[model samples]
Target: MSTTPTPAQEPAAQEPTTQERLAWMGRNSKKLILALVAMVIAAIVVTFSFSLFSSSSANPGNMVGTGTMAIENSKEGIAILTVDDMLPGDAATGTVEVTNVGDAAGDFQLASSDLVDTPATPPLSSVLNLVITDGATEVYNGPLASAGTIDLGTWQPDAKHTFTFTVTFAETAGNEYQDSQTTVDFTWDATQSTS
Candidate 1:
């Protein structure tokens, strides 16, 4: 006789059908919808708060900038002629301390010329008709010798001479002297032949 067939094993319970799932969702739909709505509101609140903080950090109106401008290789003791407060003005004062730095005698002179239209509009040159005064005498006869011209008309090396200029707006005839900033941009001719 054939052995009794083993009891048929029931298949694993399958997932619920779509219709069954929909029926279940219909009963609990309100709670599910509320949960979804709450999540969306939380997401919107977090996004708005982050944006507000980011905007303040990126505001350019409250930013500050600090920059500087300068010149290089200028001769010693020579500085721009500026106003009393060091602001640009119509007049300036500059002083120069020249040294021979060469073996043979050096001959350098301060020759100033008037400048016409310029970047700062002031008619000025790197060179100025400096009214050099020694104690009380206006030394205008010879080139300022960072050295005293003793018997020979020459500058000795390793010697230091100082000259001061009280720059004024009244230059030579017909010079259209503008603001003081123009005097700051000047080139010096320190070409005394070095023997």
Candidate 2:
């Protein structure tokens, strides 16, 4: 008797449909994307950790110290110049000593604030003349209100410099400035020299 072949013995193979192919692709793509994300996150964490460790190691034993450079004025803080019952052509003179009390050499500059008049109507600084001298050497000569910054050169540690200031009132000043008084503030700034 002859035996018939079973369905399992068939040689022809059936191809996958479009839906099956699409489902397989979807599953594989999800696994691939998840693997890529995990790898990226791990790389970022490693890079950040490396940067933190390297930066901390680069500046090992770095320390900072606190110090200061100070300058002292002869007047302590402010210098008062008073001219009472003054007439035209009257003049006054004052002296100040500037010393570097710090441990470093420094360059100094002298500046003056704008002249302030008691009576705003008549400006007394207009007719006032100011002259600054360092040991007979002229440092500045002009109107008090118009004076700008003046370089006083450099001073070594524990060095001192004396300055003389002369104020004069113009003879051309009129009665408008009779009761008007003007005041000026002086500033001394010292900066550490590079050399």
Candidate 3:
């Protein structure tokens, strides 16, 4: 007889009415609006960051590699010095010009490889002496096979430096060096001066 629930003792489980839901939303509206505003501001900042890095312009003044360094022989390009039937005490000479055609000054250095011989039985390079001169200054004077690097000093922009190289067969060479042919190559390097 007491099983029926009274209105005051009814269960509290009930869906929210439209008015209660609207009131709850209204209370939190400021927080929702602030979240949306923050998202929008972050998007704007990211867009501007991308734009700042995407656009590019070229300025010729800021370009590098506009400078040049080159070497030329008296023959206009690479030169060859041939000594046919070389005998003891015989010598040959050649010349080349190093120029800085760029707008920047540079320091120059020279290097030579050991003289290679066709008949390797007797290394003719061991019996050869080399002399290199820049105008009146002797930059290198040593054995052709053992010569290392030589510094030619600094060169100004648009300036040219002339070099003379002489190769001589040692006077002390004997008959064993006969018909032994040798060849040597020279390299010139340039680095831009900082000072």
Candidate 4:
């Protein structure tokens, strides 16, 4: 008898048709594109989060901080008390002016603190020498508003507001420190002596 190959003895598998191959590729390509889009969105979210978390100490949207002290000279503006000298039982008159040296709207608290007693003398309460005056009349007395607020509104190039806080020395406990330039050696800066 002659030996013949049976149909069951054919090759393991047949090659796919062009249409079938295209369908397979299309299915996988959709999944790949979807994954890439998700990854991109996630990266964008992380970048924004990091930027928000790492920022400097600054006010936002045209808000300025009141950090300038009138004691020092400033071109952007200044607050100064004109006085012959800062001493106890002595009167030094000056006005607190809010001048906008820069073209920025700013706010500040302008006030003097209570007289701090130092040197622990024979039991003496140091009095803050001050009297707030509105024009010629004395509106308020005692330390000239320990804490006063000044709203500059809009600086508008060059402009300022002047408010007077005239004060007189009440009573102080310490030594005389009189000098053109001298450091008041006590709990607060006061007259040690006229040098």
Candidate 5:
């Protein structure tokens, strides 16, 4: 009879005991915690990334703008005072209406420039006297040569003032001032008020 080789039998598997299960679990606990931490971080990142698409808009009436400062006068291009063939003790008076036409308040001022005297010697401007008044308040009372810049005080928007200008040929003027004439240009200036 021919003898056949018999195959080796495999051993039967056995269930793990309670102590072995506990030990296995303790070893794998760190991996479980790490996996849970990673999952939570991913969730947080996704939540924050969704916020990037959020947006908002302002109201239609919400607007920004700027203010303007401007000034004007009634007698824009007219002469305030004129006297022809003026003699000693002669005077010429004129009235002008100055107004703050701008929407903002400002400081008002009066200045004189371009004084032309026919004869430099015994200049007529030296002997000519100027008296400026606003109501009862005298703004200036001096010779034309000494009148530099006069402050008319602060003015509000649309405010008006009537200024009286009286120019007199000094009575003391002698023959030296005869036939000598003086001309000056007056300027009205306005600057935005600080307050």
Candidate 6:
């Protein structure tokens, strides 16, 4: 009669059951587990890449040392030559041994210093001629006061060299040098050799 007997009223909708809600959550949880597994796999790969490219080294035997430079003479501080009663035309010769007394090779040199005159008037050193020789090589040949630095070449550790010093009273010296006397010191210098 009325319309077509209004369609049977549909049953009221019901709230989701606990089991159905749990089933929905379980489906989403599976997707979440898969994403977490992917993240863990990515982290492992990054760690291995860093380990493969890393490098390291060590040197336990490395060492260092230092060397020394020094020299000595057989006479040390003693005089190489001395005379008291020297006169005109008189000559004296003395020999000394020089050595390199260090752990390294060095360049040796000889020079005169600390000259003293007794009378200080006649200047005895001017009239005294000095000649120094090392084997066959003449190291210096000049007046005692005019001798310059003389190079003795390179010497190795523990090496020894003989030197001869000869002083001659010039025959041309006159009576003014009768009471005049002279004294001097011999100096040895050493420097480390480059070669």
The lDDT values for all models are 0.48, 0.85, 0.80, 0.45, 0.88, 0.90
Q: Model 3 Cα displacement at 83 (Å)?
A: 1.2
User: Tens digit of lDDT per residue, candidate 4, span 75-148?
Assistant: 12332454555566776666643444543333333333343333333222234445554346454565332433
Using lDDT as the yardstick, the better of models 1 and 3 is 3
Kindly report which residue pairs in candidate 2 clash with one another: none
lDDT tens digits, residues 1-195, model 3? Answer: 678775686687899999999999899999999999999999999999889868667776664556565543354536446678878898999877777776777888887765578788788888989898888899988888877788878888877778888989988999998878887777777888887
Best by TM-score: 6
* TM-score, cand. 1 vs. native: 0.34
Write candidate 5's Cα lDDT for 52-167 as tens digits. Answer: 79999877887788565665656778888888999989899988888888888889999988898888887999988999997778999999988889999899988888889999
Tell me the tens digit of each residue's lDDT in model 1 across 1-195.
889989999999999999999999999999999999999999999999888766334545686764322112235444444454222233456665545555544555544444333444334443233355433445553322222322212455564555565654433423343333333333333334446
- Stretches off by above 4 angstroms in model 4 are 1-90, 111-116, 120-125, 132-141, 144-157, 171-195
lDDT of 6 by residue, 35-149 (tens): 9999999999999988998998988988898888877788998999988788889999999998898999999989888888778877999999999999778989999988868
Candidates, ranked, lDDT: 6, 5, 2, 3, 1, 4
Each prediction's TM-score against the native?
Answer: 0.34, 0.64, 0.62, 0.31, 0.70, 0.75
lDDT-best of 1 and 6: 6
Off by over 4 Å in 5: 1-64
For model 6, the run of ten residues with the poorest summed lDDT: 1-10
* Clash totals, every prediction: 2, 0, 0, 10, 0, 0
